[model samples]
Target: MTTAYYTHADCKRHEMGSWHPESPERLQAIEDQLIASRINTLLDYREAPAALESDLARVHTADAIYRIRENCPSERSEYDHFPLDADTSLNAYTWRASLRAAGAAVAATDAVIDAEIENAFCAIRPPGHHATSKEAMGFCMFNNVAVAAKHALEVRGLQRVAIVDFDVHHGNGTEEIFNGDQRVLMVSFFQHPYYPYSGTEHPASNMVNVPVPAHSYGNVIRELVSERWLPALEAFKPEMIFISAGFDAHREDDMGQLGLVEADYAWITQQIMRVAKTHSHGRIVSCLEGGYNLSALARSVTAHVKILADLE
Candidate 1:
């Protein structure tokens, strides 16, 4: 089995600020670990192509797209920022970076569905799980995985796709976009009462949202995945699997209080792989979501990708 790695140099150019946890260095850190672990050369590497407007339209509203583009600074020297929310902002390169990130998802999906690779992982940033159809929130500009999931079904003709979001925060945007769509099933675990604070309420039937309390541990996630994620994934029998892989739940990342470690990330990845092996014929596409601390993020991502690439 081979894993395809997708990323872009523009992804490193879109910086929110000096203080933002979701910085360009996050991607660099992930790459550093991949090289250190000797996993970088073990798979196919590709520059992520920019996603087409048509693909993005599958999950985002035209108004939102217009507003996002309109908000982009004309040039790097033209402006410092245009805040989307208190957390998200538009720098000069944000628009292109967002497009590349979304495009990376689409590219990964195509590669996997076309059987060119066993699976794929997108290291592009500006995480998407928090972006809703109409608004950008929580450091996300476009719903990357949602666009890919839609592309898988609408363009690639896949009947069913499963999205597994294990970010420390709920994938509220993904749930909202694919809420009642029978073609997709989104399973996730996030800390309750967290940022954007809305997943604990009434969720759609297709959404399997398990809320974790603050200070929880990886064991909690393991039990939940075994009891909640696997059965639903098996029953749905998805033709393709997409993971909203986030490492913020790690013990070393101060982004959340989940207390998970690299081992936990690898464990969950293995479980997801097994499910894909059974139902999706090993077709999987994982996109980076949240991981703050450089060291922990790198280690956690290396662990996750090692299993995905069969380098473990």
Candidate 2:
């Protein structure tokens, strides 16, 4: 039950602003809790490497990659920012950090496939689920999990893969990238009418998108997983599984209206693990996505990692 913990120092150096919710402190908070919970010692630590341009090409368009690289801000005393949108920005360190974020996912995928570890959790920032193939927005630079899924298929020669996104926001970027691709089966439950609101329309047959209303509780998510996600996953029998593991739905977090707690996250992880063990050889790679409230994010991540590590 070895679980690799993938992260990089560059992740903390990428910041939108002092007041932004997606601050660097989010990673530190998870680190503090893992120590407090004594779960840090039970895991294997790995530094995330930089992703190659070819890896980015698998999911992101060349124009998108060129935009991110060319728009990198030069070093300055006051630190300049290139705003991708109203809520997302790119600082000087963003290019390096974005590479690390995507790299962590790819490295974790390789590790799992090679059986270096049963699974891995990527503690990265500049959360990536919202970035589409042609653009970077919603605090995301590149679609990290998508790159990993593609790497698994193209490089590792996997026939099929499953991406499970539990983020509060709909993974419009992920859905957009893998929309008509039959090799990838993406299942997710996101708050409807939410930010980047776009998951409720006619999705591809390979997608199982369950859009729930705001204020939906943990029970609703559990039921959706049982009836929607599990059936598709079982039928697909993915060769590998990737999770856009966002904890913003925690009841204590104000980022979203969904009322999910730590125990609920644990239950969800258990279900994913069950399916992974049965179909995917217990191979899982989870990358960070969203979760604003520091305390809730830390505690929720601890719970989720505990299940992945088989600690509890």
Candidate 3:
């Protein structure tokens, strides 16, 4: 079976502002790199559908959903920003694109569950690791991975699902949604004293949060995963795995100081693949989170997707 690649053009239509780091160009970067690397030829491409309100309600409250929907402007020239905390902004196409981005996760989950594909990667954006159930923050509208995880358990009747977040920033939103849910295991590594800086203290039992120092190298991350993530993941014996795949830790990306290179991302993907192979029957679904610098983001994602597509 081939890996499924899920994306939509409407994802490119969602924009916060001209100067926002989480720009539409991020998706274009990954698409261009995948095409140039000939990696697109290795996978099955699928169009992402817009998520229904019920699907979104699995992770976010109806009121929060209504607020986001109400905030989306009707025209591009019109400006109405609904502040979900401080950083996240809702523009004209934000609601539709957010639905499509979340929909990509649901579609990917469905593909993997039905064995239509062994794995899937969602290359959409306004990344979603930061939006919690009641609020949105850090460039996220709805929690895409959380919604997928919820679907895997509630809809697919899976006993266990694991979410591995390798974003430079903490997946606080995901943790908030799944903190007490025993059916889910979340293992993540992020730079401490960074944006949304709360992962370092009083984390939930189900969360394996490794808050590494800034300027740390890939070796540090590798060691943390080896010591913390693998053991917990093996013990959990998850039936499927989800990845919040973020590449901002790359040395060239100014978003974070962690000195990760492209090979580091490839190595992490290989490690996750091993776990998936051994426990989850190679069932893995990955969604994009954060990566700002165009060149570094594209190159790092190329490396990550090469392994996900089994092209490497």
Candidate 4:
């Protein structure tokens, strides 16, 4: 089976702002590298479908959902109103793009569960994981990975799912959505005392929140995964694995102070795949989260995807 690649043009339309770091160029950079490396030919490509309201409702509250939609301005052409938070905003295309972002994860999950592909990578935007059950923050409108994890459990009849987030910022939102759910095991690390600044506090038992120091190198992250994440993940033995694949932790990206590179991303993907092979029958659905620097983000993502597609 081939690895499935999912994305859509709408994702590019959900522009935060020209000055914003999470620009549509991020997607273009990845696609360009995939083509340049000829890795695009090794995978199956599909347009991401819009996420159904019912699937979104499983993870996000009705109030949060309604607010995002109600806040979406219909009259705007080039730009839209600032949103509930300063960092995130709603353009005319944000609503549609957010749905597709969440939907891509759902579609990826479906493809993996159905054995249509060995694995899947969703190249979506309006990066989720920062948006909470109650509000959106940190350049996010919807919690995409959380929605997919919920779908795997509630819709697909899966008992356990693991979320692996290597984003530079803490996925406070994902942790909030799956706080009390024992069936979901989340192992992640982020730069501490940074934006949203909440991972250090008391987290839920099911959540393995590792707060790494600023400017840490790949060795530090590798140690965390081997010493901490692997044990928790192995014990969980999830039926499926989901990844919040963020590449901003790269040393070249000004978004965070972490000292990771493209090789680091591939290393983590390999580690996650090993766990999937042992327990989850090699089922994995990964979606984009952060990673702002265009060139570094592209290289890092291609590295992660190469490993996911076994082209590495």
TM-score of 4: 0.98
| Tens-place lDDT digits, model 2, residues 11-115 | 999999999999999999999999999989999999999999999999999999999998888867327888889999888999999999999999999999999
Model 3: runs farther than 4 Å from truth? 76-85
TM-score of each: 0.98, 0.99, 0.97, 0.98
Over the stretch 1-312, how does candidate 3's per-residue lDDT look in tens digits?
A: 588889999899888778889999999988899899987888799999999899999999989899999877777554655556556787778888999999999999998999999999999877999999998889998999999999999999999999999999999999999987899999999999898888888887899999999999989988998899999999999999999999999999899999999999999899899999999999999999999999999999889888987888
**lDDT, candidate 2, at 181:** 95
Candidate 2: which stretches are off by over 4 Å? none
The residue-by-residue lDDT of candidate 4 on 1-312, one tens digit each, is: 589999999999888778989899999999999999899988899999999999889888899999888777784465766567777888888889999999999999998999999899999998999989888889999999999999999999999999999999999999988997999999999999898798878888999999999989999999999999999999999899999998999999999999999988999999999999999989999999999889999999899998988886
Give the winner by TM-score: 2
Predictions: Cα RMSD each: 1.0, 0.8, 1.2, 1.0
lDDT of 1 by residue, 1-312 (tens): 899999999999888889999999999999988899887889799999998888889889999898888888878454488988788999988889999999999999998999999999999889999999999989999999999999999999999999999889999899999989999999999998898687778888788999989999988889999999999998999999999998999988888989899889899999989989998989999999999999999999899999999887
Better of 2 and 3 by lDDT: 2
RMSD of 3: 1.2
Q: Is candidate 3 or candidate 4 better by TM-score?
A: 4
Which segments of candidate 4 are over 4 A away from where they belong? none
Q: Stretches of candidate 1 above 4 Å error? A: 76-79
